[model samples]
Target chain A: MSRKYQAQIYVTLRPSVLDPAGVAVASGLKQLGYESVEGVRIGKYIELSLSAESEADAKTQLDRMCDQLLANPVIENYRFEIAELAASV
Target chain B: MSRKYQAQIYVTLRPSVLDPAGVAVASGLKQLGYESVEGVRIGKYIELSLSAESEADAKTQLDRMCDQLLANPVIENYRFEIAELAASV
Candidate 1:
C-alpha cells in the first residue's frame, strides 16, 4: 500500500548571492512606514503532494524533485519537510 | 535593551484562487520525468531581520508588515515564525 505525503519545500539564495528583489521589498516596506524592517530576503516556497510506499521513499523522491526541477543548486539551497497525509487505499 | 529577531514568512495562495504558476510548475516537473508529482503549489518565502523591544513587539511589527506590503490579503494567506537572534548592546 502507498502512503500519501505532503512536502513543504523552501528554496533560498545562498548568503553570498545578492538578492535585488529582497532589497526592493525592504525599501517598499520602509516607504510604507514599516521602519523596523531592517532587511529582507525573498525565496520560493513550494508544496507538493504525492504518494509513496514509505517515508524514506517519499523523501528520496522529494530530494530528486528539488534537485532536478524545484531548485537551482548552484546559487540556491533547498530544504523540505515531509508529513504523512494518509495511507492510500 | 532591544533584541534582534529573524522572521520567516510564508505566503501562499488561497484555496479558492487559481494558481497558474503552480500548474505550470507541475507540468514542468512532469516533463522533467517527475511523474510522481501529483500536484504542486508555489508560494513566497521571506526572511526578515529587525530590532524590537520584545518578542511581542516583533510579532506585531511582522503582522503589520505582512498586511501592508508582504502579502495580498485578498488572494493570499500568510504566516510567519520569529526567532530571537540577540540582544542589542
Candidate 2:
C-alpha cells in the first residue's frame, strides 16, 4: 500500500534575471511610506498531495516534476519539502 | 539606522474556496502517470527585501502588508518569515 505525502515547492527566478514585478513592488512600498523599501521577487508556490511507496520515491518524483515542467532551468530555481500527510480535520 | 531583512510569504486558498487551478493541476498529474496523485493547490511565493529598525518592526510591517494587500482575508490565508539578509555571493 502507498502512503500519502505533501510538499510545498517554491520557484524563483535567478538573481541575474530581470524581475519587473520586483521593481514594481519596490516602488509601491516606497510610495506607501516604507521609505527603506529595497526590492521584491515574486514566485510560484505549488502545494502537492500525492501517494508514493516511500519518502524517497516521493522526492524523486517531485524532483523530476520540478525539472521537467514546474521550473525553468535557465531562469528559475526550485526547491521542495516532502513529508507524510497528517490526518485531515 | 536600519537593518536589511528578507522574507518569503506563502498565500493559499481556504479549503472551502473552489480552486480551478488546483483541479487542473491534479488532472495534469494524472495524465503524466502519477495516478496516486490526489490534489494540487497553487499559491503565490512572494520574496521581500526591506529595511526595518528591528525584527519586531519587520514582523509588524509584514503582518500589516499581508492584511492590507498581500492576501484576501475572506478567501485566502497568508504567512511570512523575517530574517536578516546575509552577504550576497
Could you give candidate 1's per-residue lDDT for residues A13-51 as a string of tens digits? 999999999999999988988777789999999999988
* Cα-based lDDT at residue A36, candidate 1: 75
lDDT of 1 by residue, B1-89 (tens): 78999999999999899999999999998898777788899999999999899999999999998888899999999999999998885
- Model 2, span B2-33: residue lDDT tens: 78899889988988998998898778777877
- lDDT per residue as tens, model 2, A32-79: 777766778888899999888888988998988778777898999999
lDDT of 1 at A17: 95
Model 2 superposed RMSD (Cα): 3.2
In model 2, which residue pairs have backbone atoms overlapping below 3 Å?
none
B48: Cα error in model 1, Å: 0.3
| Residue pairs that clash (backbone atoms under 3 angstroms), model 1 | none
Q: What is the lDDT of residue B13 in candidate 2?
A: 93
